[model samples]
Target: MLASKSIKMSKEQVSTFPNADELLDRMRKMSEDESLWKKSKTDSGVDIFEGKVSTKYRQFRGVGYVDQPLATMVSVVKDAEKRKQWNEQMMGNEVVEDISEHVKVIHSKFNGGAASNRDFCVFYTDHLSDTEYIDAQTSIIHEKCPVMKGFVRATCLISGTRMIAESPTRTKVFYLGQVDLGGMVPSFVANIVNMKQPLCIARMRDFAMKDAASSSSVPSSASTSPQEEKQNEEK
Candidate 1:
């Protein structure tokens, strides 16, 4: 029915196919696609038989569109709670097997990358906990996240974000800072994360896309290496 689907799409929409499969296959896939919105519409045709089912159906969420902000918020909260449990186990001096249950809670199989960024965070923590854990985590962002390397000044509100205003612009990234120590003691690590809005994302785009070396944003030195900056823009 969708014979004209070959119409050209811009680079962005090109990745997000509105209709990925025929009606029946979509119905079958719905059980596996949690975010899919499956619906049926009446099929009015002159040649339909009485036993026929509704022929027009749709399922979609588009690619590269994981509700980034929503996913960021959800991931932060979910990971934080799980991490809290891990800390508790750590405080109790629990070992590897004990902390693993907490790790599984945060693993995301959604887009299927060799374990996503969040998974990496969980895996690293699995090996490093208690004493070594602190250094491993703080070093992770520096080693893995370019943003943290050049942090000028940052604050973590119970909001699960670090509001950073670099010279060029301000940004509030959800997974950016260390947890505030005030909430739960004796290994209590509660990092807050707020819901992501369109504005929140737009505000950070300047920093993300900026020529980091030139931008005077944030007082600290820049950490984005020449090689990695090139990689980021390709994404």
Candidate 2:
């Protein structure tokens, strides 16, 4: 199981991910640059784009919409453990630190099929406000985190996500990620990452919606556990 430790820090003491604001800006700019993105293979409403970031590496970006509340979408992103449940490529995942409710560090490994298996330790933070747009970013940061001996360490150089409420029950999401695979990767393996973005958003929406339905369907009288019921009877 993933373990977490939290420490309170003053606003000035909190270290922001380096250049996160710039990363978010780049993400927004890329999201609107539809001239670069190509339609994804999936029919799930996500658009995907890929371009060379450097001579040796390429980056991917994706945009999509989900018919779920902003809070539900944010919950999906913050629940790192739940990712392994839906993302087939995620072989192992754990949270190393909970800086606070809005910040965390996670270590995850992925199976790239024929490509080299890769792992990364990333620092993620969420910036949410009622009037300001919801935004988050994940960046490669050095920490005293454990590493899997066998997997190659991939650098999640910088990734940003932005979510905007479209209505009371809908949101627009944009994701940008730049990863260094550490070695040559097959075209097919890369394609899978590019195409999986939309599907991920869709899956999150489905899970959140179903959980909301299940919760709403349960009777309030039966919401308590057996232990709580026994304690109430004793009272």
lDDT of each: 0.24, 0.62
Candidate 1 vs. true structure, TM-score? 0.16
Error of 2 at 214 (Å): 2.3
Candidate 1 residue-wise lDDT at 115: 21
User: What would the TM-scores of all predictions be?
Assistant: 0.16, 0.67
List model 1 lDDT by residue over 1-235, tens digit each: 1111223435454222222123223323332343433222211111111112211221111111112233232232235453343222221111222223322111111111232111111122222222111101111111122222211112121111222222223222322123222212222212112111112323333323442334446655568877889999999
- Tens digits of lDDT, candidate 2, 128-229: 764224444553444456556777766565566777788878888777665555545554554456445545666666677777788789889748888988
Candidate 2: segments with Cα more than 4 A from true spot = 1-17, 33-42, 51-56, 91-105, 111-117, 131-143, 183-188, 222-235
Runs in model 1 deviating more than 4 A are: 1-121, 124-192, 197-200, 212-235
